[model samples]
Target: MDIDFLKSQLEDHDQSQLLWYWESLDKDSQEKLYNELKHLEFSNINGYFKQAMEDLKHASDKIDNLLQPLPTEVCGSVTGSSPEELKEYNRIGLEEVGNNRVAVLLLAGGQGTRLGVPYPKGMYNVGLPSKKTLYQLQAERLLKLERLAKQQTGKHCTIPWYIMTSEHTKQATDDYFKQHNYFGLEKENIILFEQGLLPCIGFDGKIILANKDKVALAPDGNGGLYRALRKWNILEDMEKRGVTNIHVYCVDNILVKMADPVFIGFCRTKKAECGAKAVEKTVPTEAVGVVCKVEGHYQVVEYSEITVETAELRRDNGQLTFNAGNICNHYFTLDFLKHVSQVEQENQLKHHVAKKKIPFVGDDQQIVKPTEPNGIKMEKFVFDVFHFAKNFAVWEVLREDEFAPLKNADTAAKDTPTTCREALLSLHHRYMLDAGSKFIHSDGSSLSDIPCAKKAKESGDCQKSENDDQFNKCEVSPLVSYAGEGLEDLLSGKKLVPPVQIVMGPSDITPSIIQNVTANGTTN
Candidate 1:
């Protein structure tokens, strides 16, 4: 913590005004400020400050035009219309997984602020019957995928799990994983790294100070994944580990398929440098980004950027023409990441501006929590690099089965804890029905076909029929079956009580036998 060096750097960047409130700090506050500055590498502070200034200056001009409908081509033939093509993709994906050429990158740098929690979003429990955290659920899926690859290829392979945390979430997330023993996966195979953070800039293009000794800083955004990979030397590690393709996804997506082989295979088989997993938008006005081409380059256009007429435009098949909603799940070849990491190629990515109500030290040196937005946080999106891809692919998936995100608290109807819980329960209930399991109520009657005389005649209770009971309270663990694939055989001739959790227990059952056994709670 060289005071002279710090002052000189600030002077050089015309940012010496940052020290106006410095002299007012007490001895302890000065020491804290010194440490914070030192840890943030104040020697190189010029670059960050300058970038923030430039971002603030150009923020207004960066709002993309939504006048024209983006030109988007279907990535591949629809799976429903062409099953063989999808089969080929699945086969290719399995082959890649078996060959040990894949890795999973999870973007978990976000805090659960929107969810009204102070911990990492991955640590929030959505009140499932198993009470599993998002991290546990995702980790277990990777383990199951590993087993599936081994079974299909007759070779053992470990898919390395890479998680990108943030300064805000790194320690808490680390402690959580340690407590859960890395969710039953090999601890060494799971790598956790922090994403970069940037200082918040006031509307006037000056950095905001949360306190006399501390500058207000925030995570740089998911797009910072590229910078993080380069900064942390993760790209080099991936290369050494023989990871050819990376499947990157957001941590909030409870249904994300880690290192999804089919997606990796699709990209590899098509010789695409980048691929995005998209789902057809549920409606024309869905508030999700649409993966489309702009002036002949691939990119994601936010819902707010499109005109209502353009959004409502439909194709001959009665589907929204620009319906491929980007789900923040992507595949990138190792070579693509390496290329993007280079200085010359890195500039292809662009930054977006987010306006937020940043609490900061006011002129009176008091922390003020403003009611309205007071500053802008600049961010680069991972998808911003899509235009740099030599060959880009988009794979459409079923949204209901693969895209329930836990984002909001109890307030919102969708993307909230309630919805996420219901989605999981619904999925598990579907799995049970597919597995030939009958739901029975407490009255010893078939839930699905309760006699009118036996059915509860109460107003609200009568409305809650077999269909409602199916998903009332159900949870299926990934250790039991990933994506409900092998449950039919495991639960065959077995009755499962509703409001039960199916988990893989600590018994020496063979993989073949264990694949179908619901160990935790099942009826005869």
Candidate 2:
């Protein structure tokens, strides 16, 4: 827009102060700024600017309130555990899957910046034996689940997979999936959508320009899922597809069970509109959010918000009172999401401010990267809607089998690609052992030659030996078994070589087992 129009619009919204730097810009810069403003719809931009100003003014008070310890209660009442309970949950979940009442939503908006990669996090390979990207692994899991549901129900069904991408990672993610042929899933069953983004604001409550032509912006956070759902009409789409429950998860988790039936079944059986899968915190001081009830409403309390005393509190059974660690895996009924997305209840979710050193153009129109935090980015978390759920459920899961996240670069000690890879391999090794398969190193030595064997021998722990494999690696395909169950018949009496990948059918088994046999062949 021209200067006169811009001035009138700003004046009409009482935001004339934004024009302070307008005259200082060169012709090119002026055009760029004007185009950006126009694209952002200058008429509605003042409200956001006003909100940002107010947010900046109250940010300090908000931080103080967020720091205060929340009153937490034991989560056991809403938590489910035990194999028998899992079986029941599985039954219910499978029924839903058979009835085509389930879908999977993957939160893949974030880039692999922490991992020191410029690509999307979903495209990063954690050095798996099959060299599968996160997206590919998740897709394969969904395909396997679909097959399982069909087998049990004796009817073909499709579980739609929805992936949320951010502006920064959307194109790269789309191209990656296209290059991989949607990882063997039917193309029509996969849906990819971009999440919303909000402009970054400086500490002084002014918008920061990333360069001469662009404004600094970031994803609106996972809580934007609600808004995105409504914006994309996904709820209506789900209804048309007969989807009742959504398995929501983050892309960083390498061991996530996609569209897990047990989780869905458990929530349905309990008549819960929302459910979360939580793993017992490894220690009282672990830097993970704890799922607990605060003021009789379900919410996750970050470790920073809890006192040392409360963090260490234990129950009579010797488990930590607030042991349920929120792992970002949740099951939400379509109706619950619809309720949360309604216009009247939209404001129930709150925004969180994150301080960061956002790169921006200086007064000289040159880009400057600060060494310290220079701006604030406001975000909304997906879990903030927990309080709106009238009925909520929490399920306890084993961390080792279900929760390995790839979050950092190799320099970090935990949650790095190396650690995630090791966790995947170790879990596969355990599955092989459970199926009565033996392992041997390249030199024909038993796996006991590794360091884990010495510790297992000292402690006389058979279970430890089963998973110890410092000198070996194994990877299991979800197509073979979802949770390492029912593999005995396929693997019994076989000697699995190190660094093997096991998939469905004998034809796909890798590392060349000691004996290759068909249904008609007998083992030596």
lDDT of 1 at 424: 81
lDDT per residue for candidate 2 within 1-524, as digits (tens), equals 57798778767755454455677778888888777665554443345555655765665441212322223321222244667877777888988998899999989899899999999999898876567778877887887788788878888988999988888888998788789777778888888888888777677656677876577888989988888888888889899999989999999999999988877877787788988888988598999998777776778887866777778888788888778889999989999989998866766666767789999888776889999998878778888888887788887778888999999999998999998988787787788888988776445556653336556667886445333443346677776777787678878877654556675532354323423222243422
Clashes of 2: 0
Model 2 lDDT on a 0 to 1 scale: 0.76
What local lDDT does model 2 show for residue 81?
60
Shift in Å, residue 66, candidate 2 = 12
State in Å the error of residue 473, model 1: 2.5
lDDT, model 2, position 262: 78
Instruction: Name the candidate that leads on TM-score.
Output: 1
Give me the displacement of residue 26 in model 1, in angstroms: 4.8
Off by over 4 Å in 2: 11-32, 39-82, 441-446, 449-470, 504-524
lDDT of each: 0.76, 0.76
